[model samples]
Target: MKGNTLQPMTMPFRVGNVAPDPEREHAAPVRIPIGPEATLLKEPLLGRYASTRRDIDLDMDAMRAARSRGELPPFGGPWFGGMEKDVAWVNTTRVIGDASDAEELTRAEVTGRKDSVVMLDALREHSPAFKDGRLLHTSTQIGVRETRCLLGAYTLTGDDIRTQARFDDGIAVGCWPIDVRPAGDVGVHAMYVPLPYEIPYRSLLPRKTDNLLVAGRCISVDREALGSARVGATCAATGRAAGVAAALAATGGKQPRQLDAGQLRTAVRAQGGRVTPPAH
Candidate 1:
């Protein structure tokens, strides 16, 4: 939701395991499509609209073929049937894999819109899809949730994870999973939860850089904290904080850490950001 209008691309993998939908007992295997590039994974998505067209064509081919031959929800059978445990992961993968193309169509339909590459050595990883490449639908360019921290005056550390640190410089509040999209477009790193949290100004700081502030997945956080702050709602708040801090620093000729704490808190409060009262 970074408001990126990145175009979608569909590049299918070499192998596929269609979960035979018992209902469609007359159809053949449905080939699942590949995912888009993370670099290109932006909102207001543009460019790769053709990928959706190709996918629909292929999926139609698959559905027709499956129906002509007879297939059903899962075309494979027993294995896919008992895969309920992995449902969450599979469903999430569909974001960049299957539904992304479909979702892009919504851009043309509702907002209206547009599309991944396949992978080679996935089974080696401890991914849930590891059963001899049985149920996994990994991609070519692994999903990358974020990049550089943008470098700020203070860098957030791992310990700040669940402790719920506060700052007069704090500018946003967010709570989500430590969701890390994988390197190849399919696999991702995520932790389940943590308390509702506020992104510290430190998270905006790069190791040794200054001025620029970073928010979203690029924030400094622990493996767990990253998961918690990765959600869109959370990132948005973090972004809002960065924007305010940057503006203040640029206009006042003050560093982020040097800004008047009282003034910073007042500004953030004005924006509906929730902060804890000072601890005497």
Candidate 2:
């Protein structure tokens, strides 16, 4: 992370789905679960006994029509994934498309709702487990994958992860692969990391903002590097580090940028974090 080097981090838009468990008791608030049982399927209806292709196609066609009418934003092909197997957890929802407009927040909201309904319809029609399932819930809001990233003390790049870059001030670690979705005709590409890479505390310190600290996908990272660090586990780790650093800085009357890296690392480790990067 370095100073005043804010970069644009973009990713394909996606939505998620959550369905009710047929075998489980109908509780007050419907539960949506996620686990290995949730398989990410490319074609919605083409899977074995889960043929809802027609529904998916119709949804896409309708979306395209909406886009033509300026009612919906442009989006890519339909994709679906959730806990579809045995009732191990509550079903969930996931949808992805193009939603880069900052001004069109309402448009994104509409698209997410439309996408969720279409996917839910498909799940109910083809999936035996959800034939009678009800839509217990939907996301209170849409999830954005990428946005404006702070220019920090250091800007992490994809090559840093590929080479297993280490840092003396490393405060967090990320091991997820560099998974990027195709913009248009380009296919989704994922490059695995052979070893975990250290995320420097510098990456979290904004250049011009002394008291502010950034965690999660907004940390100082290039778009490619973001693919790996954007996972939940990594975000949690960064959040822990930031929280500790913020507390220490506040108590000591120091700016976040002025906190000592070693002290921060010690505090993070005491809270069950892995500060040191793994061996190459």
Candidate 3:
């Protein structure tokens, strides 16, 4: 595989599960009350957020609409599934910095928190439902999307996802599209994948690391490929595969790279994971 030439991307944001105040009277009757559960997708107010340094992009109208949800998970699912809530505080403020820079990341944390408050203020101004609303809980730390990645024994690329590439050592499967939030862009740039693709165990094996195995978004993948591989479900699948491999390596007294691929695939399949493309 060729050396990684893509720069790591970063998106710093916060989430607050909000609830409406019972004592407050609504200027406009709550049209669509925040529900028990909802789906998530990209919002339309990102352009406004991108231009204003201290502003956030949230779909205020959708909060009242039943369809309003955020895409924090793969397959366009909601992260806060079973939470019994009325409102979701979706903060769209962003911070960009080098992943290796501690000062920048620290700034992201501080800035992200401050911006989240700014978003809350905007929400209050946008709707009266939250005029007296209270925050149930807020994210303690800023969420960072990408950082330094490992160039492992095998590299998963965007082409692999599009063509549904399968490997003999396949350990996990991902079907999320190539969703990238470019720095200073209005919204995410997405390239939908045709089908689910396999993640090889070789991608988890670092070239120089003897016994160490990498998983999740940090596994060997190019920049374009990371866009699709960097979601919660995909990350979890890769993590489980890595854990299984790690356990097998420890028990067998062998390096992770030296483990049998077939054995690992069988073990993962036994655990109810999809290491190959699903039949259409």
Candidate 4:
């Protein structure tokens, strides 16, 4: 499948302007209530604990009403809420269009900027916290979700995740569920996975390129499986595995595929990674 491109967004707080060594603790559990009309296409906001009342809800009723009246273009979804000290971040605009096409991408970027302005206006009008807030910055670059996936030694599939298949060369674990967005009339289809599943080392090894090792979201995986494995934490784990395997291969004067899976697992474990499956 073709890889996805990023959706550009703006932030409330400016970077670098904030004091160094900012508060290191979450004061309380931040839970933003989503309106019934909000079509959350992804998972809920998650973070560590703090006892302070920093929570804020993203009421999409205004946006939904505007959509119904054809006042705004349907481009992107909102990020419920997030905060870093005095600065809060929310993504309520998305430039819904083809990301691959040059002309469309340009248009999407423009639309994204405009949407951010509108979203900020709405936030300032409705949310008390954002009443005095100013736009700190807009992302310099657009983020791409999917692009090109390498055809590796082994490609992960939805069935592998569903069955919780174990691989002798498993190097990383993924726990996120399949979160595919809706297309046309089809609604968002999300499948929850209770258990963490293995991501095999072979998935990082490109089939034809002996020297190349793939990691992160670009690693070999079917579209359905990609949804679970593409998250930040899972990608980080896979990246660590790839780094370790690459170093071992380089030292041994061997290709990534030539490195023994057992040795790799041993090295990964030494570095505080859990390569073995938990006792069933």
Candidate 5:
């Protein structure tokens, strides 16, 4: 995070509540029911699984008023509604800003909270299901999608992902596509990856920072590559590898960069991580 910074992108301030349409009577239960029916203004839902509303018209005039008053950002598409175990759920919120800076991060947090109110209001006023629904929770902080990236021993690139490159030091695997929520763009652009790719241990070793090992979305990767690696599963895998590598390094009195890649890979694989490429 110290060497260089990745370009900022839109991050959501997600909201969740007990299922507004518990019966799934109006909401489509399928993974992502796409079309004009699912959107507020009949504008095809922008992002993936954009919203849960189906065959319902929301108040467009009211949404316009909120936008004019600067209460909402350009993008406020909903994206989560389903059952989580016994509890039903709904998430309809969006707030976008460059959160790499401390001040900007704070601003995003405030704006996200405000946007949540506007989105919830829109839902309650138009959707009968949400009108009587109980509020479960809202995220306390803005989801920081990308920030400063480490310039490390190796920087993963889009080419590596496309080619399904393997590394002797591989400690984790990633399968998400290149998902980019452009600044102020309502829809996201994504490029599917052909196969799962290896994430090397070198990517976690920050240059000139022997005592530290970076992981998650902030690990060494190009902008195009970051788009793919920034998802939750990939981030979790990288974090796991970093944790294992750190423990091994500390015990051996070695810096992260100096630890043997083979030993690290073995340790990671032992933890049930996919370190080697699948057998052909």
Candidate 6:
């Protein structure tokens, strides 16, 4: 996230077949009905599914974050339990939505609370990493350090990685790198950034529906770029832009991608989205 301007959207991903992201080559799987897999999911949905919604009992916090591994959804954070030096269980409810300084809180983190469960994200993106029972001084801004992506229109492979790809319908831009944590996950196999790539509008389109627009990792990018394109902040910006694009088409009586580039970008900006060229 260094050198990149941070822009995050505050919208939740719509729900449907938003399976999750990355690892290996995708054959551009089409959208299919839940087949009992999407039901009872708690992980945040993204991409095309981000454009739809489903109701569930979100009152249960742990259930709110649960997801089965049927489709291998793209999600991260410390793996819970099982080892020493594990930084997965940092407690966050203590400071969410409040303007509190993390450094100060981390400086006095209490790991001796037997009644509380906590995690220490030491890389300094979310919670400070605890070292020697002392928290490491890190950015309190809480950033997403790992990257993973869903399947997409373009097939980005390891051989084709380390370079950027320009798509016919570039809807989003990427400058972030691909980083994975705790040795292995589905998508991350490296500790560096791959060449930035453009996200295609088709990538954002759900395979079967004409009315949905996926934002975030749910949108399409190959297993490689998933790590970069699926950044939460950027995904939010993309979601905002997609929402405006959908709105303009809905209000002015048009198709999802039927608007003029300038008009669409302008509408997105007017709706509080940030876009650069081709419409700047």
lDDT against the true structure, each candidate: 0.42, 0.59, 0.61, 0.64, 0.65, 0.39
Error of 6 at 109 (Å): 20
For model 6 the TM-score comes to: 0.42
Q: Candidate 1 lDDT, tens digit per residue, 10-59?
A: 22222233222234322234322323211222222321221211111112
In candidate 3, what residue range of length 10 has the lowest lDDT sum? Answer: 72-81
All candidates in order of TM-score, best leading: 4, 5, 3, 2, 1, 6
Q: How do the predictions measure up, each by TM-score?
A: 0.44, 0.64, 0.70, 0.74, 0.74, 0.42
lDDT of 6 by residue, 1-280 (tens): 1212211111111112212222312233334233321132123422222211121111222322332432222233322211122222222212211113355334323221211222221212222222223332323333332233334444444333354545445555554555323322221122344434455555665555566666776565554455456567768767876777788779988867565666765666566554542321
lDDT of 5 by residue, 1-280 (tens): 4324433333343334333434535445545333312122123323434445443334555665666777655554444444342233434344445576678778777776666666666666755545544445556566766777889989999889878898989998887666554555232334444467888988988778669988888899988788789889888999999999889989999888889999988888898988865655
What C-alpha lDDT, on a 0 to 100 scale, does residue 174 get in candidate 3? 89
Task: Give the residue spans of candidate 4 off by over 4 A.
Answer: 1-27, 30-54, 75-77, 97-108, 126-128, 183-191, 277-280
Error of 4 at 220 (Å): 0.5
Candidate 2 lDDT tens digits, 202-272: 99998887789999988999877876787789999899899999999999999998888899999999988
In the range 109-145, model 4's lDDT, one tens digit per residue, is 7766666666666666655555666777666655445
Compare candidates 1 and 3 on lDDT and give the better one: 3
Cα RMSD, each candidate: 15.4, 8.5, 9.2, 6.6, 5.9, 18.4
Q: Supply candidate 5's per-residue lDDT for 247.
A: 93
Candidate 4 or 2, higher TM-score: 4
